[model samples]
Target chain A: MAIKQRKLELGVLVASLALVTSCKREDRPFQTSAPSAEAIQFTRMTDFRAGGPSISGNQPSPAMSADETPEEKEFEENAYMVGEGKRLFSAFNCVGCHAHGGGGMGPALIDDQWIYGHEPAQIFCTIIEGRPNGMPSFGGKIPSFQVWQLASYVRSLGGLVPGDAAPGRDDDMHGGPPENSAPNQKPNDSSLPKSAEMPK
Target chain B: MIAAATARWATLADNDFGVTSGEWVRGTKSVLDPAGPQSGRIHQLFLDYFWLSVVVYVLVVLFVIFAVILRRRRARWTGPILAEPAPSREKLRGWLVGLATLATTIALFFLLAGDHAAGRAIRSLSTDNALKIRVTGHQWWWEFRFEDEAPSKIFTTANEIHIPVGRTIEVELHSPDVIHSFWVPNLHGKRDMIPGHPTRIAFRADKASEYWGQCAEFCGYEHAKMRFRVVAEPEEKFNAWKAAQLQSSVQPATDSQKKGQYVFLHTTCVMCHTIQGTTAGAMMGPDLTHLASRKTIAAGSLPNKRGHLAGWISNPQTIKPGVRMPANSLPPDQLQALLDYLEILK
Candidate 1:
């Protein structure tokens, strides 16, 4: 009886193999468009990381945006959009991973180690499509509008965006300059010793 | 004073630490007393090896006593058989030893055949008439997703799984964080849930009762406390549970409950959990849509009661060490209201 059962299982396994091989390849695109006409939502990505940082600089300046509408063009330098991203940075627990731009479980957002590059669009896509080490994609949980806000804020984290485009402080007690503050200054190279050793 | 202390300890035991002694010795956790066809086959194989070992032990002991120690050491002058110089019987002795060796080989072959039969009985994974469920293991919890051909028909759950009795259920096991094993001793043997690669465990549970399952693999700090329940029921009851799981969470009934709902959504609870129909759609933690219907909370760490729920909400780290959830330091009133809201999730 057991032998017969084993033979049956073997037969079933063979049949499944044939069925799977003959089936068409399923290409499940993870990029979901916005749900409401309010935004271009796709179901695959809408649920990625609702609270995580969004990558597509929600609204880059039309000049920088490949396909920016007038609505999207204003997001580039919009202080309100930048401020909203700052709030999302904390709410989605981005502060938990990339701690105050210094880094903890994730890389330092303020540093030069751009694992995925530093374009506004690149950052936006990086956030949506998470990286290997620790970053989780926040495509769905966070609306696309909020993702744009988050992208603008993340761009300002490394002083990549104009200092005026970043937020300094608020009711939420986030650490940094206001969106209208000074631009990021290059560190002085004069502090380094002329030689690679201490003066004798 | 002593009685009061004893009563306090008893309450502690009930809420934390161990289960009752009766439940341990002859409970659903016992692998010896199986309630499913797969488990029964495994138990039979275990007994087969155990009895075979016993027989081998007895035979070796008898050989040592009668053949080696008690045989003929005192014999040269006392035994006629020893003095006979049995050269003529050498062929006969060699033949006898060869026959005995042949018998042992045949016995071993049958034992191996029995083992193969047991393995096949449990792990066939044939699901033509079977129900399918995906069991994903997280850091210290279990997440269950019922399978359906249609995407909209599928629903996810946490901690508990309800299956129809006397029907094969194919469980696709995977782990997102670390390695873990699923073991419901009363139903089947353990199967490892690896990280990327998924495995299947197919079994037909015959009985209609709650079977306790625990993370048999050491996953992390809370591995020992990571437990779940398999509620095997009649087909109708199982279907009812599934139906309830598919629906969205109910709204709060009273004024305080509504206020509690506001607090829960506003707080950090939404950061890690999903309460369907609300803004709390994060999947970092378990689904809390049908939390109230479950028998226990925190993945079977405590009984689902008002005080335990309140205590757990206040300080999850105290009951189960290294749990991912941090203590929510809400004011007394807000905490009470949140608990009230959570109780109505059914």
Candidate 2:
């Protein structure tokens, strides 16, 4: 009778230990898998359709999902997210210091002189951890997903590709005008330049 | 006693009362004469307005006193007596027409004169070369950058501006943050400095002198403390001073200086100020690259000395309340070292 009782106690102890070990395993951080071939293909299609560079793994679109319906997919691909980002950018008064993309008190976001990396994650980090020189940290003010969308809009301004976009094709996104033209040229022409020449 | 009190009040309002005895103030009197060439034009306009205002005030005061004294005792109780009203419509019309014509003429003259003066000050090309200085306004301080100099040759001074005597000095104003106004009473009027917009002001001092200036606009809580000094020196002395300011800071020779440099890097100072050629590249605050070269500290509110610098670094808020610069707590050794290092800014 005593041996049978000891065996039951041991069985109960072993079961409790096993349960604790499983719970610890569940607490481990999630490890994401590397971008798959299918993901890359889908990103490229979206980038090409959007008239941007082929998407890379570094810049995965936040809304990229294979499970979404056709209607949902159309909304993600169109100007809805970009429009939301534009509204947030103005609402937050980013243009007040940035001055319509022209550098002023703050560094120009539209220009190529990015102190932080141009990647979405990098841009998100910058907004989260504000840089020196009068920039405030908006991590608490803005939601994470909204920050990513804002980053996407800022990336789009210089006409850079989204994540999963092809590299070395930045020139294809130049829809407005060519490199050089007279200062007083018409805006509709492709020959209009980007900026005025510096004083001699 | 009442007569004596009245006499004392009258004397207190005289021009000679409470006059400053500083050398700078005396020099400014001669150099920045209200009757001088540049100021003379503006001076006349101001005088005309001043006399007009004085006359109006005197007439109003006299009328009030006369009406009070000449009032009938019975008339006080019986107000608005029943009597035949006089016809004053033609007189009223004539007065209105005369006043309108006079006001219009005065307004037109002022507008044209002001426009002409402003045009001459900003755009007129002078045969005499002007001394150019780029003045960048930060939150509560001024950064003076001289033109026609190399990167290494660049000198960053605060608050005090040094120009040669008898030369037109052109100040190109730019603001890094909010709007700031630059004004010196004896030198020139206030000019607004807008972000992304640069404005220029031109003024000349006839003699070697120092003039006081204050940020006229309500910029921030410490706006009143944001003062500057314009030091117009002899041509040769100005050149020498500029050469000295242009030179690189002397290296830290003592152990205290080395320790101060270490403290500067480890402290909050590194987060806001920049000491050029060092890792402190922060543009949020005034560049302390050549701090020792400046004549005054805390935006000209205090003299730049070892004790004041230490006090300022220790508790800036106590000296200038609501200043954006935070007061940093430091040990005695660290504060001493920092002061030692800063004293060699030239």
Instruction: Report the number of backbone clashes for model 2.
Output: 9
How well is each residue in A1-200 modelled by candidate 1, as lDDT tens digits?
A: 99999999999999999887534222111222221322232212223434553455333222233242334434446565676577667767898888766688987666445556555555665666576667775543344555666776776776656554456665544455554453454422132333544687
Displacement of the residue B80 alpha carbon in candidate 2, Å: 11
Following a full C-alpha superposition, what root-mean-square deviation does model 2 have from the true structure? 19.8
Q: Which stretches of candidate 1 lie over 4 Å from their true place?
A: A1-200, B1-27, B72-100
- Provide DockQ values for all models, in the order shown: 0.04, 0.02
Per-residue accuracy of model 2 over B116-221 as CA lDDT, tens digit each: 7754753453525777788988768888888764666666667777888878888899986679998766666679988889998887767555666677788877
Candidate 1 docks at the CAPRI level of incorrect
Runs with alpha carbons beyond 4 Å of true place in candidate 2: A1-200, B1-40, B59-82, B85-128, B149-152, B276-281
| lDDT of candidates 1 onward, in order | 0.72, 0.61
lDDT string for model 1 (B1-346, tens) is 9999999766543333343222221125677768888899999999998998899789878877886654566465466455545776787878978987997898799799999998887777467878999999987999999999988879999988889998889899998777999998889999999988999888888988777789999997789878888889999999998889999999998988898888778666776788998888878789999999887788877777788899888878788766766566678988889888899888
